[model samples]
Target: MADDKSKRDFRDRDRVSADEDYEVEYFAAKAGVTPQQVKELIAKHGNQRETLEREAKALRGNG
Candidate 1:
């Protein structure tokens, strides 16, 4: 469950953060990757901001 905990700490789901919906686009743009690539990154890593950013950087750096 360690990975589950890293998927963001927003437990109360009644209100959704606007940024959460745009995570794919945001990270994709920030990392110069595609939205689909961002989704793939999420699958491999996690939805946590740090994890997503780290993976995005690694992906960009790898290419």
Candidate 2:
């Protein structure tokens, strides 16, 4: 069977994709941080969703 590249299974919803602009933007907006900040967070803390969220909140003085 051919792979469906257009389909998003959301299997990795619990993690953020640093390479995907949409995922970074969504996370940034939700975390009250800029997209650039989200990228930096991904770099500094890795792509784990909870870690990024906690760090982003800290950046925004919310955590």
Candidate 3:
């Protein structure tokens, strides 16, 4: 399932950067999703590693 966060390396969430193309592309690759998905995740969860990890863990629990 898309919500199953355990399958992904949440550590990649720590890569902080502006909404640049390369940053987005890198993050998308790290998160194992598309660049669009990376943007959406950043928009939805904010660009903080702690925040993303918490949200991801929560999403995992809910999965």
Candidate 4:
């Protein structure tokens, strides 16, 4: 159980690192949502930067 938890934590850390260039926090704030919510959306909808940006824009009422 501990090993599984550790692996999940490592994967989460890696995902955050992979998204480091995306300014997720800034966009999430602009979209009036939590960073984890934006991350989940990105993971669900495909991890494409353009797609995330469009989603963020729409959430922020800019799109």
Report the C-alpha lDDT of model 2 over 1-63, residue by residue, as the tens digit: 433558879778689988888888989888888999999999999999989988887888954
Candidate 1: tens digits of C-alpha lDDT, residues 1-63: 123435766563322122354645655776688888877776676566666677778888999
Tell me the spans in candidate 1 whose CA falls farther than 4 Å from its real position: 1-21
- Ranking of predictions according to lDDT: 2, 1, 3, 4
TM-score of each: 0.60, 0.80, 0.51, 0.44
| Candidate number with greatest lDDT | 2
Candidate with top TM-score is 2
TM-score, candidate number 1: 0.60
Off by over 4 Å in 4: 1-18, 47-63
What is candidate 4's local distance difference test score?
Answer: 0.58
RMSD of each: 8.5, 4.1, 11.0, 7.7
Candidate 4 on 1-63: residue-level lDDT in tens?
A: 122433454334322322553556755775676788688767776656556667667666743
Clashing residue pairs in all predictions, respectively, total: 0, 0, 0, 0
TM-score for model 3? Answer: 0.51
User: Could you tell me how far off, in angstroms, the CA of residue 15 lies in candidate 3 after the best superposition?
Assistant: 5.0
| 10: Cα error in model 4, Å | 32
Q: In candidate 3, what residue range of length 10 has the lowest lDDT sum?
A: 1-10
RMSD of 2: 4.1
**lDDT (Cα atoms) of all candidates against the true structure:** 0.62, 0.85, 0.60, 0.58
Q: Relative to the unseen true structure, what is the C-alpha lDDT of residue 18 in candidate 1, on a scale of 0 to 100?
A: 26
Model 4 Cα RMSD, 1 decimal: 7.7
